[model samples]
Target: MSDLQFDSSSAGIGEICKAIICLEIAANMKHVLFDRQTAIRLSGMSEKAYIRSFNVMQNGIGVKNTLDIKELAIQFGCVRLIPLVRKGLSLYRERFIASLPPSRRASADFTRPVFTATGFYLCAKKHKLKVNKNKLIELSGTSEDEFSSVSTSMKDLCHDVFGVSTEKKDPKSVKVNRDLLDVLPEKRQAEDGGYSSDEGKDV
Candidate 1:
């Protein structure tokens, strides 16, 4: 038992230790991965219940951690740690797209049946290669005129949002960017052998 120093140094040292511990915990959590089924097993909740509870928590907090398990499940599919992996990939993709010149950006907007990032994602998933204006409108639950009004925006998303290439064949025809489309993981697998050879290879 030596003489104890009742100074700010002790308090500062304690705070530093706490900060180091918090960072370690955060780093570990960021690497944790679980699928929807695994998450259910861990949380001991049914699918519906988990969704409901997650929604409540999300609403209450009004802020979200990028590593929140439930949010990752919803945004990046049910694949383990895929959302975390995608977070990095998305940042790189966003930076690349944002770096492009305005002339190449092709920013446009649809009015009725309002277009969104999700909308573009859905459209890409639904239409494989190419689609006409009317076909896109039908898929989007919008009137033909509304789709026509926002056609430029839709076209812009081809490169800006979706990273897909586009070609205007004529006044009524726009070719979907299959070159960029093939880069999708699912499509790549399907094109290769209907399965990724490296599937289940842990990141």
Candidate 2:
């Protein structure tokens, strides 16, 4: 055997097949865990592409009253990946609010809460609409007498845009949104379980 090249006979084929299967099963059972931040590295996409796409969607995509899911799906690579796109969006929104300097924190009034300022920023960013705080306040003409209603409106805004719970009395309460960062249901829900019109399955 030392003088000759050791070669596998036809009988060895069965053993080779078993080894390959064992490797694949082991890989499947391994804890292949990663977050959106690390998904691009783990997957086929390039690093440059992931960064560029993430930034454009977050800083540039307008939240104008319209929700465009197809456009988003294409940007993220596949329609099935909408859930992942939301992850990047959530981080962007959270970071934007967290960046505010001290003096800008919402005032004591609950209706005209200081976080309304952050909500305004989100509305502008999400809807592609430009809004100046002074203009909005002037438009609503928030008078002292209307504080209760204004505070209620502010609380609702807090829930929708920032996902932060307005019910909390704690000064240091964190802002968060319960839903994923996604387009309005109208634009997105209709596209669920997607197939093309060219290949219709529905009656």
Candidate 3:
């Protein structure tokens, strides 16, 4: 890390952004992209403002050695926002990758979609459960503010969650991939791309 003590308080948002970039390098988390979409959802900031704040933090205190950036840790609450420790995440991602069989490792970067809306609806009904549209939205964590596209996206998530996904449908339904599922803070499984919470132990 540079020994430079930049007085970023006087700088504009652009400079603050520079601080973030500098911090990412210092923290050695270059491969892991900041999850802006998740942040936007949690922060309740407009997309434009979210991006701007991220930039400012990066350029300001990130480059200022005198400031106690660690305090932000308590403020943000979620550890995910704290600058990543590259060594730790690297060890984590690598260990999980190694645990996967060759085939799964090859496809870790891509996610295939699971099912049709009708299939999901039928499956839910078969379980003697009614598919409340609002309930679906709650489970999917999507907004009803936007119409058609949002609806379709939630349906897709629901289809996957219901195990109605036709693509790469693993009917045998093994325990979810430990690598993918285990990495979450709570060891969670994917429910074969569609069902919700198969086992509390798994996630």
Candidate 4:
């Protein structure tokens, strides 16, 4: 054998080799995707070594940055609702930014799990999909309290921006505001007559 020394532990030679092999296989076989076991076998790396390397890479890259809402939805067994979830996430982000003050808007950031849970909940509700709130919370890895708070904000956003009411209304108890009604005629008359209180005032 040729004289060669490799410090696999310190240099992460195994991980680098595994990654290169896996990438080459993926590039060559466009349609074929390898599972963890297959990838480990093909890479000639031990399972533990592969797992440790994956963890190191994942941690270095940052889990939050890599977190995917679509993957989370699949984990929650809502793969069929990905489109709705995406729409909800987009609208939620818009509404969230609009709600923040100019100064705070720049610093605005949401807890990822809570944010994802809220978006999923909102879209599921809007579409009348029967999703378990508890399951969503569990899958998102967020507490019930946190999810509830964010969900409340999302509901308000749906009502205010989309005109989709989240609360039940009692039509029987509805009463017209007579005072506001009495002011409508005068307001209409002023508009129609091109009349304004400031019209006669000199600038």
TM-score of each: 0.24, 0.19, 0.22, 0.44
Top lDDT model: 4
Q: Which ten residues in a row have the lowest lDDT in candidate 4?
A: 176-185
Candidate 4 deviant stretches above 4 angstroms: 1-67, 160-203
| lDDT (Cα, 0-100) at 17 in candidate 2 | 33
TM-score of 3: 0.22
lDDT of 3 at 78: 25
Instruction: Kindly list the per-residue Cα lDDT of model 2 for residues 46-138, writing each as its tens digit.
Output: 433332232222223231112233443443234554453354334434443454445533421122122233334343444444445443322
Best by TM-score: 4
Error of 2 at 89 (Å): 0.5
Residue 102 CA error for candidate 3 (Å)? 0.5
lDDT of 4 by residue, 152-183 (tens): 55555544322246564332232311121111
Instruction: Summarize candidate 3's per-residue lDDT along 22-127 as a digit string, tens digits.
Output: 5443432322223334545565655444433433343334432111223322332423323432222233335445656787676553111111122233344434
Candidate 2 backbone collisions, by pair: 63-126, 63-127, 64-127, 106-114, 111-150, 111-151, 163-176, 163-177
User: Over the stretch 38-87, how does candidate 1's per-residue lDDT look in tens digits?
Assistant: 44445555444343333223223232223333443344343344343344
